[model samples]
Target: MSKLGESLRALRTRGFTPVAARSAARSFKGVLACKKGEISVKLTIYDWNFLSYPHIQVLERQDFLPELMPHVDVAGNLCYFAPGSVTLDRYNPATAILQCLDQATAILDRISLDPHYRVEDIQNEFPAHWEYGQLSLPWQVLLGEIKPNTIKASYFILEIGDKKQALISNTPGEATRLAGALGANFKPSHFQCWILRTKSLPAVPQKMPTTIKELFDWIKIWDHDLYGKVQNILSQRDYLKQSYMPFAIETPVGWLGFGFDLDRIRREAYSRDPKKYRQYLHMKGGSQGLFRMAIKEVSARFVHSRNLSYEDLQNKRVTVVGCGAIGSFVAQALVRLGAGTGERGILKIIDSDKLGPENLGRHALGFPSLFRHKTEALQEELLRQFPHGKIIGIASSAFEYKQLFDADLIIDATGEEAVSELLNGLRLARSSEVPVLHIWIRGNGEAVQALWTDSTGGACYRCLTIPDPNHHRKERFELLKNAPVLRTDGCRAFTPYAVSSPLHASALAIDMICSWLQGSPSPKFRTRSVEGADLYKLRNHDPSKLKSCPACDPT
Candidate 1:
């Protein structure tokens, strides 16, 4: 016997018996007859490969639990281990199997004794449980708010080219904004929907309710509030029709949908009396159809707030002074950080230069943008992918448009001395009206540095360039020994930084922006060195302002 097969022999004393498993080579299985107090469950250890988690399932086909059982699935599969949460000892396969068996039974024992834990566990993952219903749609997205008791729902049509996708949300106005962003003409949908949100969920069923009557029974037992509301709506006079009622439940996790049609259309011929209409709506036969649906949440609230931990730049007005290699990435990253995605948000780009074939090697834009103004091309490219951003492109100089400088934050990626000094003067000119973030590449991609200037008396952009006693404005803490060698293709000259330089600068800016949003943006300046670069000794501490310098220092 293999070392793992010998491990199975230990379970015999614990009422487990070995079983032949043709479940691929080097796999194992055994039926575990475990009894916790009065409750007994026969589970089988199915798949135990080095590649996957040990698949343990209840042995009897009829003993499978409901979808809402805590840590246990519909097929009686027990989830003992969360993937990537722990490192399994692949070296000791024998011990690993024994450990998994113990953990699986421990979960079973706890849920068997404590019913409240099972309720909370199911409610926490309610969306997943509700989706397993046989008649549910694949998924849905929302763009509207949901409140308890009231019914607010509608059907929307979204056309992405020739492919038309119909979906449901709470309001037509919010849905109109989302669908209109794709440049499609808006029209009302014929497929009407009704959404009823409830404060609590229904109790776990013996099996997922397949009939409308079974669902009503489950709701009556667990949720008195939802049951009361559903009763009042269905009891309305003369509103009874044979048409199917398509509706969704706005739960905490997400929306879950189910629909049922009335048999009155077929049965109405049997009865001409008004009292017979109520009798025709009864669900006595299995032929009374009941199916579930999916409500995919494509709403700004869910779509934008789901995965983010830090505050996104949703409603902030941001202006990019350059749309070159570094600024292109900065604009793209800012959009992803939720800039220009809110109702009052704005993302403006200003650059006088046009994109060339040579700029593509180190730029965020590509061949499609050749010869087009960099600001306009970046706007075109970004809007094609993320139409939610309110992007304005100006194919002109940043200095000429004085009103363009008005922003919540200005990102200067032009990397020019004249521009930095002018921006510093503007901060002083406007009494630090708005913060400016200047990010640039230095010494041929040796490092990328960024400085965030937000205070009136704090370190201005010119503080880094203040002249020393030797009459030369040098690095306060130098990291580079030699300057970047300027490269020329005979017509114009430019520094030949690699493609990775702007990306590094973008990463640095993103971290600084996070700190800025957190309201404690200390260590205002930051730098990152490229690995394996033959550079001088690094001096990367945050530098304060000079006391007697020219631009920012008091005279």
Candidate 2:
């Protein structure tokens, strides 16, 4: 006989009668009767390599008294071993089956006496198996974060068609009207809502009564105002017709909706005394009752956001210097990418220049921001779009800021050689390590370059410029050395690059910054540009450590 067959015969001898066996399926079904209760067990070998660690399920008497146990699901499958905790001898199938049967027998004995006995014995891992329904929201509604004690009135937009649905909105009247205009199949109802924000998402029952009385009793834990308002609203609708009550609630993760029916609940209440039911609906106290009810199941739909994972970027602190054309666009892109919002992270912008008419062509801010400091204008523009974002604009030169040393990452977009050199020095002198990125445009916006320096010894900004045999220092790029500088009125010489040129540079810089934040190994430098009449193009440069460098290696 096979080892598994011998094990089954041994189990039958021990009072575990085999009722059915499927040899092809590698499964055995049996029942064991004890003084406590009868438990029908099924053992199946899911993986031959791990034959000793077979999957065990209790077909009958699957649910214990309370039904909250780790390694066990509502369907009664017993996860005999915690995930990755299986230690069994693959060759000894008989001994493994006997051990599993012994454990299952002990579990049944304890559950028959007290279902919570095992839970009380093993406090850990119960939460992992806790029964709770989840509610998801599109965007994290502020209402969900509010305290329950805070008295506030909110509204919901119900989209009830083939399926019942709802969305939290600040503008209730407008949302209802808009839903009607969209030709939704169901009649819209104006709802007065209050959020019950809990540590865990509220547990919803599988079935809830659809009646005003039930809802009244459900929310009676709140103030009399809520109970009285709901009563008045439901009284206006047909007493006999089926009506749905749409309400909004807040959880730690997101918002939730409850679309309850009134007609069914009213029918259930017909057997009770009218006077008692009225008094029951008006009963008022503290939030204890509501808290208790929230622990159970409720009818809710989860509306999760597609961009929920992007919220992780809020943990990064980024500082951008020189809020000019490239800097402004980079700062805005970081905010849109979900930086500096959730945690202690922030996006600090430093610039001493003002938004003049000349900057309107390539700057992120428009004519409305003229005369405002570049940092302040960009900060305001970003806040208008992302109200919850953390942005600080400092109207000062990058050299004057002492807090740059504490930032997680720093980007220098001043396009000034002097400022880049100063920042490189400041970074090397700091006790705390901070990565620096130097971004600038070449002559006539023909090409742009971004040089990233790591905390460890690497190429600094000055490494890009080395003295030649004639003792004249020149940039590593050939185009920057030969391209003619555009001269304005007096000594005002600038590069005549179009607005599109800086935008391309901004995109390249932002890409490098994001990659670095995501833990990519920093490269020496990256450059990009389009082919033009002057054949102005800069290749990606990989510079070696300069022996006579001042920032990185000083004698």
Candidate 3:
């Protein structure tokens, strides 16, 4: 159990009555008083061990207190305060001392950045705290001290109209919204007690602290100036960076693009540092990355075109290679999605090998068709299902097709490394004239890689994947030479068909065909890895030069 937990139980071991402690807690509410029409709050002391005083600066640093006591009541017991004797009021008095202490303690956790802190260095060297006198003492700061008791105090300021309004919001969400509305910005530290906004603010949020390295500098600098008073930061720097730094959320990059009347972040920054603002002026504020563009276009298309029907895909010619797990699903999805269902349609099923009992689990062909060649069996099934749609069966490997007879879209659905290499070569060769859609299941059966390459636009598969020059260079070349005939053995025993592997490959094929038929953006190359979700384009690849690739390079 935690040390705090153990200490709390210790209080129970002592002879303290629940009623007496509760009464004492309740009686100490003299410090709390709300205006007649304002929100009512209460306070009650559950036990003596609950009382612990904190420092003001620390409280300011940890700005979570107001949420704990959202409203102050007329009674001694706070409606939102902690389970202890305490009260907070706008006024001060002797009897209200306990009330003040109670309310202050309750808000300490909300105020202080660190509950456990020691102050050191009272001299001019560390002057930030001199305003508080005998400054830089090691103690837990409280929220009440960091921020005055008045709710009206200016925690933030913004120019809403003709006047500059000082804003001391009760909540962070409100403060942020107000800051955005008034064309004001705030540093992270300024957010400690609600927020006090002004028309003038810093260029960057205050809490960001210029750089991540500032923490180290602060520790070293403070240590030298406040030698014996503060804790040594050297030992704790790593822990703080790892555990605490991330929790300090920075301001939103820029005000929301809601077209509000508030001044833009750049305009406000320009007033402070004209040169820096000029440099920043070139930095546009919008997400324009490839993925973002894809999402936006897709969404817009979906919204604009209300009648995109499956019937539109009727006369499309699709060539599907590799009748393995993915090949089966690809064929199934194509037909279902209206590729080869009726007249004027064609679906070519290609595989140079037969199906075995081992492939039954994933193959579309049934047990009755086992032992038969995969291409013939699938073609028979397709004919049975859609007698009018023309079905072509190529009982040979992809390389055997000296030229893909006139396919609107050629799909390579095989997941073999050898198959991928072969298709890469073919794709590079035909990229200029015929567009190829290559789909393959990754090794783990978790994801699939799909690439679309045409002679007109985007990079080909070779451009996406270039063999390493250091290792296995000769072996890769030899493999490429034997590619046409090597698939006679079919997939090796190690690469077996599974549910997920084929599903991913098939999904990618559908995406490829959709992009082709509708002129959608081409699929990216780095998306080939099963674990990679973030897509990236290969910039270093050159498909035009065959010197680097023996199989596809005509030169």
Q: Backbone collision count in every prediction?
A: 14, 9, 44
| Tens digit of per-residue lDDT, candidate 1, span 80-128 | 7788665667666567767777877677666665778777877777667
Q: What shift in Å separates residue 108 of candidate 1 from its native position after superposition?
A: 3.3
Candidate 3 least-lDDT 10 residues:
290-299
TM-score of each: 0.79, 0.51, 0.37
lDDT of residue 243 for candidate 2:
38
By TM-score rank, best first, the candidates go 1, 2, 3
Candidate 3 Cα deviation (angstroms), residue 400: 3.4
After superposition, the stretches of candidate 1 with alpha carbons farther than 4 Å from their true spots are 1-29, 37-51, 59-68, 90-99, 133-151, 157-166, 170-188, 198-202, 235-242, 262-289, 468-471, 530-545, 548-554
Q: In candidate 3, what are the lDDT values of residues 214-252, reduced to their tens digit?
A: 322332343343321122221222212121111110112
Candidates 2 and 3 compared: the better one by lDDT is 2
**RMSD to native, candidate 2:** 14.2
